[model samples]
Every structure is written in structure tokens, then in C-alpha cells.
Target: RRKAGWVKERLDWFEQMSQLAVDREYVSGETFLYLGRQYRLKIVYGSKRSPVKLRGKFFEVNLSQSMPEQDRREAVRRAMWRWYRAHAWEKIRKIVEHYSARLGIEPPEFRIKYQAKRWGSCSQGSVLNINLRIIMAPLSQIEYVVAHELCHLKYKDHSAAFWDLLRLVMPNYEVRKENLRRSGWQYLL
Candidate 1:
């Protein structure tokens, strides 16, 4: 009976420890997986480690030196966002210019941001806002997004005419749209 009680106590302690491990929030010096990369968190200032790495199936992030967990996460996110913004802008600009000239339309001013729920949006004044996260998406999908917003310049609503305009630019817009919807979460991460 005593042995049984001791075993139960040990099991309870083990369960508690497991729960703690599962519940612990972000911590410096801990390793975690993101985007199929394994990142080691280091808490040293002026360290030479890059913020993120694209391993075979995961992404690794190196915590900023002497940074708090939340701050470190924010820093990593900012770095990723910056990189995406530059790449996406370059790609989108080329596409926009190509299509704009072909359609004989004035190009809208473009802006990139970290939007939570929108891939892109166009204003009444013809300014286009694209999510920076779109950079991480496939190139074809990004092109589709740009074309979709450009269509709005002619047809502001999602009417059939808007879709027709989109089709004029991207015959496979639907397929690209579906692809973006399916893999959009990858960018958010």
C-alpha cells in the first residue's frame, strides 16, 4: 500500500511538471519551431546570430541579446516583416508597372503594411495597400493580389465587372485566389 501511494505521488508530480512545460510562455534561451525551422533563443547582446533561418522544414529565430521574451519576439517579427516588405515591393512594383502600361492606366501609389486580415486594399484615390506578409507567399499569388487591387481602380466593387477586369489581366485569377486563401496562414506566422 505504501509503495502504491508513493507511485501515485510521483505520477502527480510528473503530471504537474508536464503541465508547466506545456503552459510556459515564450522564454529566452529556449528553442522553438516556426515555419518548419528550429530557432535557438540566445540572450546575449551583440551576438552574431541571425534572427531567423529557413531550415528544411522549420524556421529558427535567435532571440535578441539581453532582450525580454516579448521584445525578442517583436524584434524577430519586425525583421521578418522588413525583409518581406522589401522583396514584395520590388516584385509588386514590376508587376504593377507592366500591367499599368499595358492597360494604359495610371498606376496607383502602393503601400505595404502588416495587416491582420487583409491581403490588399485600394482606396478611392487609387492608392493600394498591400500586406507585407504577402512577400512570403508564392510569386504568382502576389501578382494576383496586385492585379485584383488594380482592377478595383476601374471597378470599385466586387461586381461581375470587377471580376471581368481581373480576368482580363489574370486568366487564372480564381486559381491564384484559391491558392492565396489556402496558404495565407503561412504568411501570418
Candidate 2:
């Protein structure tokens, strides 16, 4: 009975949170996330070759002025994806390097890809695959995911030993994990 009450409360909270980011259309004035900060989208008429640039507090996307309204939205979306993927790799690479040294393991090869349901995963072969969207999350959350995966190099499964190692490195990992869970919807875009 206690478990059922907790589940009901969690479900209600999710329902309320989902209403926060209902706008999926990539248009000017709509907000996007980067490193846990919100940046408003700014569509501009300019070169299609260089589509996206993060300037100050806005993600400015360049598209042809003559393009139809529908196409402009898509162009902005694609530009944002490209920019995010590039930045994710750059940031994650450095984080992995930093944590790998602290953990006493060589930085394993890593890739940033679009993952619909996972923040990160470590394979038996020691490769780290990070979701590109996770780049939108705060740096602490990203560090937690990287450290968690790197720890898997020592322990393949989520056994007690594995968690002990993770806790040793990231003392406040549980707090970061809960924050990620509560704010995940904001990063869906």
C-alpha cells in the first residue's frame, strides 16, 4: 500500500512536468538548452553553409530568407542537432579524459550518438557511448554519467563492488542522478 501511494505521487508529478515544454517547433523565441542553461532560438536570414552559431544567450540559425516557413523550422532543427553533436563530443571527450586519469584507467574510446532512452552505456569491449542530448544537461550530471561508465571498466555489472567504486569517485552522485530525473523533460528538445 505504501509503494502504491508513492507511485501515484510520482506519476502526478511527471504529468505536471510534461506541460512545461510542450513546444517542439524550432522557431525564434522558443528556448533550447545547453549545459543546463536555456538559450532562446534566433532565426536569421544568411548563409545556409554555416547554419548554427551560439552567440551570447541565443542560438542563431542561418537560413535562406526565401525558404518556406515549414522548411525554415526544419533547417533550424537540423542545425541545432549538428551543433549539439559537435559540442557534445568536444565536452565529453575532455570530461572522459579528466575522469579516466582520476580513476587510473586510460580513456576508452567514446562516441556521441542519438539515443532515445539512455544517457550513456559502457560495453564489454570498454567503449563508451553517450547520448548526444545529455550534453544539454548540467556539467555535474554529465560528469556523473562519465564516471559511472568508466567505473564499469572495472566492474561489468551493477554489483555492490561497482557502486562502491562509483561512490568513491563521485561522492554526490545520487543528488545529480535525482536532479537529472526531475529535469529530464526540459532536455527532450
Candidate 3:
């Protein structure tokens, strides 16, 4: 009975993952997030290699009409990755600089990471790793994560002092933490 239950649970988890993958399939007019704002995709068939740009309220995708449907999807995916990576690099660096001096800790070596369990982590070597998906989050939430990880530089563990430091840096950190936990499901894609 225990073995059967375990197998059933595994199957259910796989099914949910598959469903989420399908749901994330990109299509024209579908909304995608950036800095907590949703921009609807506008596919405009065109001739350039550069295919994605944020124009006003729309994330316009310029593509070649001759491209196959499958190829177009792949192009969009690649374009999105490029967009996220470029923005994340700039945003994360600025946040680290802003908080490092305020917290009285030298800024750690920050880099983008694709970790499954954490939005950010601080290493013993003073290196900070931020999950790239966080680029999609609101600026406040991104600051909260950066503050929380920087706090770890002073306090290695999630001790009371760590929370105190986090609170000092971000007064409403608890709210951001809670919101981050709830919205994390969306980043699985």
C-alpha cells in the first residue's frame, strides 16, 4: 500500500508539471510579466534578427513571417531569455550596491543563478547568488530578497538578528516575504 501511494503521488506531481508546461506556452496577445507589470505580446512579422522589444505597454515581437510556427515559438523563447538576462544583470547590480553600504557590509560578488529552491543565497565566501527568475518580480520584492541575502553576510543563519537586520533594511519585509512565497509558483516556468 505504501509503495502504491508513493507511485501515485509521483505520477500526480508529473501530471501537474506537464500541465504547467503547457500553460506556459507562449502565444500572441498573451501577457508576460516584467518588473511585476504584464505586457501583452504583439507579434509583428518582420525581417530582423532582433525579435523582442518592450514598446509602450506592449512587448512587441518582430519575427519573420516565413519562419515555421515551431521556430517562431523557439525564437520568442530565446528572445525572452535574452531580455530577462540583460535586465537582471543591471537591476541586481544596482540593488546590491544600494544595500551594501547601508548594511555596513561590503557588497558580495553577485551573480545570476538558476536554483530551484531559493530566490537568493549568500555564500560563506561573500558571494551572493540571485535566481534569474526574480527579474520578473516587482522591484520591492527584488529588494527584499537582496536585503535578506545580504543580511546573511552578517548572520550566517536565519537567526533573530538576521530577521532584525532584514527588517531594518526593509521595514515591511514580512509582507514581501509572504508575497514572494505565494507568487513563487509562477516562476516554475
lDDT of 2 at 133: 85
Clashing pairs in 3: none
Candidate 2 lDDT, 56-89, residue by residue in tens: 9999888898898768777788889999999999
Q: Per-residue CA lDDT of candidate 3, range 1-189, in tens?
A: 769987996787667656666545566888788888888888888657467788898888888888898788778877777778888899999999899988987778998977867899988788999999898888988999898899988999989988998888889999999888666656643
Model 2 quality (TM-score): 0.91
- Model 2 stretches with alpha carbons more than 4 Å out: 16-23, 47-49
Clash count of each predicted structure = 8, 0, 0
Better of 1 and 3 by lDDT: 3
- Residue 78 in model 1: shift from native, Å? 2.5
Off by over 4 Å in 3: 1-23, 47-49
Which model scores highest in lDDT? 2
On lDDT, who's better, 2 or 3? Answer: 2
Flag the better candidate by TM-score, 1 or 2.
2
